[model samples]
Each structure stands twice: as structure tokens, then as C-alpha cells.
Target: MRADAGAILRIDELTVSFRTDSGEVPAVRGVSFELAAGEALALVGESGSGKSTVALAALGLLGGTARVSGSIAIGDIAVVGAGERELQRVRGKLASMVFQEPATALDPLMRVGDQIAEVIRNHDDVSAAEAQARAVELLGHVGLPEPASRVRSFPFQLSGGQRQRVVIAMAIANRPKLLIADEPTTALDVTVQAEILDLLRRLAAENDMGVLLVTHNMGVVADFADRVAVMTDGRLVEEGPVDEVLLRPQHEYTRALLSAVPRLSVAERPAAAGAAGAAGPAAPAAPARERYVEASGVSVSFGRGVRAVHALRDVSLDVAAGETVGLVGESGSGKSTIARAVLGLIEPDSGSVRVFGEELRRARGRRLRQLRAGIGVVLQDPVASLDARLSVAECIAEPLLVHARGLGRAERRRRVAEALEAVRLPAAFMDRAPRELSGGQRQRVSLARALVLSPRLLVADEPTSALDVSVQRTVLDVITELQRELGFACIFVSHDLAVVQEFAQRVVVMRAGAVVETGPTAVTLSHPETEYTRRLLAAVPVPDPVVQRGRRLAAAGGAA
Candidate 1:
């Protein structure tokens, strides 16, 4: 493709390949595109579709094993065949890249301010104090609150949204002409996602920079990008204006993807709303049998004396068999603590926990192990949870090996295959290592591992949050199907109300380490009583136009 008049970045016939044991894996297949100055183009595709590879290749960030063949021009310089030194000269000064997971991209051990300042020092001979001041200003520009104080904190000390903002601060520290953001909003809550998108838009507009946004979220691309490119199986299948792509998609893959996204506009809700009138499902009746897990008057305090902070205060709840319960809260709301307590991984200072009507808080050794064996957990980030060295089959077989040792080798293999199939994974993946799979595939493997033992209860903490929309839908479907087939209960924990709405029959609203409200999903959502639950429901993504219209109509009605 030729440059569109005056283009900041242009690539013609770019192809990228990696040498694998099976053969050469063609990642990007002769893809050609152009990004004019101040233009925002979205690279939309599912996992393993080569969207990220294209972005990585443009900045000359591909691995040594990758073979590239094409012409890439950034500004007036050619980067396709540039030497390491030449590329380094162009990297931060000409174009910068911001990865999806800011926590992983930023140095956890270093203060965030130092990391951003280092970028400036790498390009310019600047004093540490000057670079530090510039870093603080950059952080402020990215919409982070208290940027000065936050700059001194480590990556772990900031929220996911704030961490992403810091990463943006680092990316734009050198004021590059082009910024490549790869799935910047993945795994964030809807409220935080909107804020981050807004920040990116403002930054790109203010700098007059070309932005290459790589994501699978149609909502984001439709609302933000000027143009869109659809990729499939390492090939660009469609390219056009964002509206044309979203409203009138030509490619079958794009159509399938658009159809998969769940919309809240016409979603089914419960017969009654919660106290706050937030849309939710009707509450289901609690099971009559003894509670499988119960916590009473739970309180957890951190630190000591003046520094002592109460993370959980008088939190109480119960989970019954054959039921799915949702724990809803924002980050650091102590929902994870609740999960940990149920798993016997944490002990509350002043509370009683009972499993199957037996005291579990005091249980130790054999009894604790037995209780834990009946429960399973799927964490938010699968890459961190999975063992990179183990093959997919080996990972799935671990739970079975622990309990059913008497089973023959063939039987164990057969069970592993069945578990994999349950999660809709291809059988060929059994031989592949965790590193070989994409983010979504690794999550499926985690689900397979958890389900192999046929546990009665599953603790899924944002299980599909890190995946693309297509992958999220598929993963949720697998979990629902497995739950129905095996008659296993689930404790769905997430900040995404939309996802939890689909999974749980009941919902529990948690804030500041306390259960503010609990009721049937339909009833509570349709009519949320607590202000926190209402805020959470309102924070869900509605188009800006729709929000404005709703406000206007409400104002008119109020006046009438």
C-alpha cells in the first residue's frame, strides 16, 4: 500500500515468521498498511491472529527467531532492515510501544518515576532531577490522580488503571510520533476501561501522534478509531473506516465476532430490582441442605497498632451446593480475601468458618487437605498460574495424579483428554508447552486442570477477564456447560458486572471489605439498594451518546 498523502508510518508487504519445531510459523503474512499523522487505526483480531506481531515488528522488537521480509518506513527513516544500533536510535525517539499488562511491562522493583525517567535518559543527556520532573508531568497528562506521589510508588502499589496510565506516561516520555498500544484495556473493569480509553484518545489528539490500537473489543474500536483493520489466521481480511467495519462488516470472521459480544441493552433481568434500582436478576432460593462453606463475623487486620488496617470487617456469607454465587467488588475490596479464606489459605483473627457443618478454621493437616481437594480455583491471570515448563497434558493430569493414583496410565490419559475436550481445547494442544499457547488457550488449560478431579466447588476469580471478547464468550460457555454437566457449584468473583450477571444466579455486593448487600441476581441488579452497587452498575459501559440522551431525558422528566 502506498502512503496516504503524508504518512507518519508506512509498511509495504511485511511478512514475519518464526522457526518452530514443527516448521516455520507464518505470523504476519505480507500485511501492508499506512498511518497518517494524527490518525488512530485499530488492529482488531482474536488471539494468535498476528495483530500484536505486526505491532512488535514495526518497532523492530521481534525475537531473534523471527524472520522478517518487507519494507517499513517510520517518518522518513527505513526500519525494515535497519541494524540494531540504527533501530535503537529510532526506537524511543521516533516510535514507542506500550504493552497490554502494564504491571508486567513496568519494572516492579523500581519506582514508577525512575522507569519513566530512564526512558528520557536513554534518549537525551538529561539530569536525573529534570527527567524526574518531566516524568511527573507525563504522569499527570495521562490522567493519573496524585501523579507526583504516585510517581514514587512501585508498579504493585498502584491500581491496574493507574499502572496502565504510568505505562502510557513512559511510552510518551520521549514524545514519539507513533505509539503502538497492544490491548491496553484488557482485564480492566468497565469503568476503568472507559477512563483509560479516554486518556489514550486525549493523549493521541494532544500530541498529534499516530496510534495503532491493537484490540478485539468492538465497543472500543467503534467509538475511538478513525479506521479499522480485521485480521484472521495471519492475514488481513478487511480494512475500512471503524463505522463501516462495525456496522457493516464484510468478513465472515468479523460478523461472527460482532455477534458474539453480549449487549446489556436487551439483556434479561430479574423480576425485581435491588434496593438501588440497578438492573439485576431475581434472587433464587437458597438450598435447604447444610452450607458447604460458611464464614461468620470474619475480620482481618493488616500491620500493627497505628499502621493496622482492617481489610475485612465482620464479613459473613454462606455458599450452598449446586449454586453459583457471585462476589462483586472493586479492586482491593477483600473479595479475594473471602476466596482465600474459603480455600483454607488464610485464617481470620476473629471468625468461625464451617465446611459441611464442621469447623474448618481449626482443621489442619489431613482434614484440611481433604477439604481443599474437593474445591478448585481458577485465577485471573493464567500465565502466572500455569507452569511454563509443563506441557498442556501434564498440567491437566496433575490433579488426577494427586487423588486417583490407582488409575492405570491409559485411564489417566483418557481422563485428561476428556477434561481438555470439556474446555473445548484442541487435542493437539496436549503436546504443546504452556508458552506455545495464547493467553486464552492457557486459561482453558487452567480450567481443564481444575475440572479434571470433578471438584464440587470452583472458585473462579476473573477467569476470563484477560481474554479477548470472542475468547471470553467461549470460556464462559465452557464453564457454564461444565457446571451443568458435572453439577458442580461455582463462586464467581469479578469486577465485571456484565460477566458475573451471566454466570451467577445470586449476587453479593462487597465494598471496603464488607458485604453491603446480597440477594438474587435479578432482584439486586434490577433494584440495587446500596450506593456502591448502584455506582458499579452505572459504571458499566454505555455509549457516550446514550449516556447523554439518558441524562437529558431524565432532566426533562424531572422538570415535568
Candidate 2:
């Protein structure tokens, strides 16, 4: 592909490969694209599909092991084989990048303002005071609350959404002609994701900067980008206008991706034939029905005095046998706190938590261990949760070894193999390390490990948050299938209402450590009674451009 006169960033037959022990592994195979000024082009693909590799190659950020054979031109600078000095001259000044995870992107020790100021000073000749002032202005531009005070706060002191805004502020500090945002909203809440997308749109328009957005979220591409590029297996399968690609996708992969996205409009609550129990304001347990886990009037707080943070307040919840309950809330809203309280990971300041009819706080010694063995937990980040040194088999067998010591080695191995098969992973994967597996596979291993103990209850906390739409759908299907076959109760914690609507029978909305709303999934999402619930439902971006435009317009009118 040839670069047009108006193009600010261009890639021509960009092929990238990495030399590994097994030999050359091609990441991007002859991919070509262009981003013109004042336009937004999104690279949509799953993990290891070369979307992020293309962006990194454009910025000359690839490591020494990488081999590039094509042309990448960011204005007058050639990026494919440029030296460090030449690449440095182009980086940050002409092009910048906003990474996926803001927590790791920002320096923990330094104040946010200084970090932005440093970026500005690196690319321009300015005094420290002038740079500091510009940093504050940029922070304000990104819609950070109390920019003056927030500027002085460290990254650890701010919320996840606030930290992401600070990262954006730094990326745009030098006013680069091209900005590459890689999965910027993947880990954020629906409301915060919408806010960040709006901020990027405004900034791109105001500065007339070209944006290359790399993400697996088709909803975001539909709502934000002018054009779309679909990649699969290191190849660009399709590229066209957003509406054409999303509404009338030609490629099978593209169509599959669109289909995998959980839609709130089409989702229905689970049938009541085997519905477990109501979530909020728990009633007396029926004699025939079994309550797997229950937390009543639970209150938890961190620190003391003026520094105290009330994580939970009189929050009551219960999960019935063989039922799935979704817990939805924004960050720091105590969704995870409630999960921890139920797992006996943390003690509540007041009230009680009972699992299988045994109070968690009161259970001790052998009784406590026995009670804990019946509960399984799956965390958000599988990579962080799984040990790198351990093979897949060892990771899955760990629970059995701890909880079921009487089981012999052959019995444990058989259970591990069974668990892997349950999650749709082959026995061959048992020998592989966690690093060798994909994000979705790692999550499946996490599920297998959680299920190996044959627990009566499962707590999956944002297990699919970081996965691609198609992979996320597969994982959710695995969970549902396993739950149906095993008859285990579940508490699914996530901020994604669409996924919750599809997966959970009962829905609980939490805000400021209090249960704002709770009801059957369909009724609660489609006909919310509270403003907060309405806002959350509205914040979710649809995969259709026309619908998203209407939603944005309605939101703006409401704000006005």
C-alpha cells in the first residue's frame, strides 16, 4: 500500500517476526494500513493477532529479537529499521502511545503532574514551572477531577479511572501528530470506559491528530472509529468503514467476532424451572431449597478514624444451589470486598457470613478447612493468579493436594485431566507452562483449578474482563456448561452488564458499598428503577454505530 499525501502514519507490507528457540515466529504477515490526519482507524483483533505488534513496530519499540522486513513511515522518519537516535527523534514528538494497563504505564513513585511534565520537557525546551503548568492544563483537558490537587498525587493514590486519565494526559502532553491507544478501556468500568472514549474523541478532534486504536472490542470500534481493520492469525482479513464491517461483515472471522459479543437487547433471564433463589432482602430459606452461601448485614472497613474507608455497608446477598448471581459495580464499590468476605479472606466488621450452613467467622481448625475446601475462587487476571513455574497439571492438582490429601497421585492426576477436559482443554496442555498458554487458555486453567476440588460454590471475579469477545464467549459457555453439569452455585462478579445479563439469573447492583438494586437479570437491566442502574445500562456501548450515536446524543443532552 502507498501512503497518500494527507497520511500522517503509513505501513507498507509490514512483516514482523521474532526468533525463538523453536525458530522464527511470524507475528505480522505483510499487513498494510494508513492513518490520515484528523481520522481514527481501529485495528480490531483477538490476542496474538498482530494488532499490538503493528503499533509497537510503528513506534520502533520492538525488542532486538524482532525482525522487520517492511516499511513503516511516521511522517518523514522511517521506523522499520531506524536507529535509536532517529527513532527517539520521532517518538513522543511526532507519535505517542497509550498502553493498555495504566497502573503499570505510570510511575508509582512519582506524582502524576511530574510524569506529564517530564514528557513535555523531554520533547520541548521549557522551564520546569512552565511544563508543570502545561501538565495541569492537560490533566484538566482529560477531565480529571481536581486537576490541581490530583496532579500532586501519586499513581497509587488515584482510582483506576483517574490513573487512566493521567496516562492519557501524558500521552498527549507533547501534542503528537499520531496517537496509538492499545486496549485503553479494556480494564475499566463501562461508565468510565465511555468517559475515556469520549475524552479521546474530543482530544483527537480538537488537535486534528490521527488515532490508531488497537482493541478487541467491536463495540468500541463501532462507537469511536471512522474505519475498521480486522485481523486474524497475523493477517489483515478485512478492512472497511465501521458500519460496513460491523453490520455486513464479509469475513467469517469478523462475523464470528460480532456474533460473540453479548447483547443486552437479545439476552433473556434464565428459565425459572430450576431458578435458585432471590438475591436481595433474603427471605427464610425454604426447607427443600439449599443456600450455598449467605452473607447478611455484612459491614467491612479499612483503617480507622479519618482514614477509614467503608468497603461494605449492611450488604446482604445469597447464592442458591446450582444458581448464578451476578454482582455488578464500579471500581472501589466493594464488589470484590463482598467476594472476599464470603471466601473468609477478610473478616467483616459486623454481621455474619455462612457457607453451607457454617458461619465463616465462627468455623475453626479442621471444621474451617473443611468448609473452605467446598468453595472455589477465580480471579480477574489469570496470568497473575497462576504460578509461572508450575505446569498446567500441577496448577490444577494443587487444590486437590491441599483439600483432598487422602487422594493418591494417580487419583489426583485423573482429576486434573478430567478438569482440563471439562474446560475444553486437551490433556496435552497439562505438560505446558502457563506462559505458553493464551489469555483465554490461562483463564480456562484457572477455572479448571477452581473446579478440581469439586467445590459446592464458585466465586468468579471478572474472569473474562481481559479476554477478547469471542474468547470471552467461549469461556462463559464453558462456565455455564460446567455449572449445569456439576450443579454448583456461582457468584459472578463483573462490571459488564451485558455479560451479566446473559450469564446470571439474579443481578445485584452495588454502589458506595451498598446494594442499590437487585432483581431478576432481565427485569433489572431492561427496567431499572434507580438512576445509577440506568446510567450503568446506558453507559454500555452497542455494536451498532447508529444506536451508539443515539446513546451518545442522549447522554450529552442529559448532561446538559
Candidate whose lDDT is highest = 2
lDDT of model number 1: 0.82
- Model 2, span 432-466: residue lDDT tens: 99999999999999999999988899999999999
Q: Distance from true position, residue 474, model 1, in Å?
A: 2.1
Which candidate leads in TM-score? 2
TM-scores of the candidates are 0.89, 0.95
Clashes of 1: 28
The residue-by-residue lDDT of candidate 1 on 187-271, one tens digit each, is 6776677678778888888889999999877666765688899898889999998767777889999899888775544122221
Computed on alpha carbons, the lDDT of every model, listed in order, comes to: 0.82, 0.90
lDDT of model 2 at position 100: 94
